[model samples]
Target: MVVALARKKIYEEIADIILSEIKSGKLKPGDKLPAITKMAESYQVSQASIREALNSLKVLDVIHVKHGQGSFINEQMPLGFEQNFEIITKADIANLLDLRKIIEVGCVRAACEKAEAHHHERMAEALGKMWTAVENNELGEQADYDFHMAIAVSTGNPLLANLLEDVSETMIRTMKETRRIWLYETEKSIQKIYDEHKLIFEAIKNEDAEAAAKSMYDHLKGVEDVLLTNY
Candidate 1:
């Protein structure tokens, strides 16, 4: 059983407790997590807090949620997942977004040419999930990350896919942070971000490499601008 958490940073503390359980082998990979209500009771926090904790874990690729089912530990967790949660400075985030712009812009161009039907299906599925999350007032960070990863996979370049996977933990963290800024600190709506992603997906679907690259560059640059200005 998890211990009750203090009021301060309650959701983050709950996430850490769950992580400790996973690291201790008490919650093995593929194990189904307790129901949100059960977790809230165990942690002495609200169900909203429990959901937030699970969402953070999901963004980090430590867990995966099945709609209408429950969350589960990811079958393949990121390497050194526990160590990757170190504090990230704003400068670090800015630099990381810059690197993403360089990498993802090129990846989308290749995806426009190489993406197969199934790859497009995966991107569409991710976009659908993002829309659902947005409508439900959730961060939808995992779906956002999945959309980008689908683009990388669509590139048909294993090295590019693997490179993105290697840095995924940090990438998801920044995504969540940026989305939080957009949702809470600014006038931008999550719906607008979803629309930007749809524009990228449309370009890729149409097999327009130049358009896809430009869309991706514009999307990432927009994110970078908002992140740096607000965070």
Candidate 2:
């Protein structure tokens, strides 16, 4: 007897179609994708699903959105980048967090060793924005992700930065989950996150690799605990 595969969600199906088009050279680099309405009509899916599919492409760096323009394929995107983003799953949040811990903790350590004054300044700025957002009762998810990306960029490793960027969708999901948990379940949890980020930044600023890695690990562990326990 043969087992049937699970049906793909409409958005996922759209995403796969777009990916296949790109891989087949039907959508070349620097080419702007068709409008959402057009794509929806073509694929016989809702515009919302087409939008989601385009967002997934953005997450994978297969395309970049330009406001007032349209989504254009990344000129420098590597071949087969879509393969890296094919395995989207709701149940993979925990696994994504685990992978994040591995990659980001390593990035923190490397940042401590290799980061320059400008890199430290960038992280500090992102940290400041995060604090401001928390004070304003906003999620500050973008700043949070930027702070982490700064650490990765500080490593001066394009490959590492690309690796982290490739997982942008999952990272954003994890960040939103972190904020949601803190906003609803844990009181004053934003303060705790602020303090953790401060510690991580300071360790990197002081060029303490072990401390940076430990601080990053602890920060991620706290988020992981919240996710695993509540989610």
Candidate 3:
């Protein structure tokens, strides 16, 4: 009984250790993790404990298991989560969007508090590019990404900025998909995207953290709705 309990506790600890390695970038997407037997030996734990840890990671989408081949880190995996755009299900997309919203809302709130005049200027410039893109019938994904990334940078938080950078592939992918849908399926979605970003910019310019966070949420909520419901 005591050994079983010890194994349980050690498995959880081992899982966290592996997760931390992935988050710290020691382990990367598509990187084949050590074999379970090796991991068990390295961690001084039983193979059962290592197996349990890897199983948990698989459940969280941190790793993919092949029957004969060793487990590999998921390419779509997020930093702590996973920002892979090549998702298999709508639920995966929803999970990514939810996490993106959490990070962005916090960044917007912080940007409102800390962003400088130049930061606001950069966002305005990005918005201008977005407008031009829409007028030209382009997706403007880069500009859209830059605008949000600028907001994260404006917060003066490297961690937040890195998080945004880490999930950029997901952001760009979602932007392209949503833009295409809005253009072909919905009307005035281009304008709506511009308007939403404008709201976020205005709130930041006015230094209203609460308002900025809300606008960001509303903007993202719209994207989530379109993708999940319409697309």
Question: Which 10-residue span in candidate 1 carries the lowest summed lDDT?
Answer: 84-93
Error of 3 at 218 (Å): 0.4
Q: Report lDDT (Cα) of residue 48, candidate 2.
A: 79
TM, every model: 0.64, 0.63, 0.62
Residues 70-125 of candidate 3: C-alpha lDDT, one tens digit per residue: 88998886443633213223565588789988999999999988999999999999
| lDDT (Cα, tens digit) per residue for candidate 1, span 18-40 | 88899899999899999999988
RMSD of each: 11.0, 10.3, 11.4
Model 2 lDDT at residue 183 = 74
* Higher-lDDT candidate of 1 and 3: 1
Q: In candidate 2, what are the lDDT values of residues 55-82, reduced to their tens digit?
A: 6565455776666787798898744574
- Number of the top lDDT candidate: 1
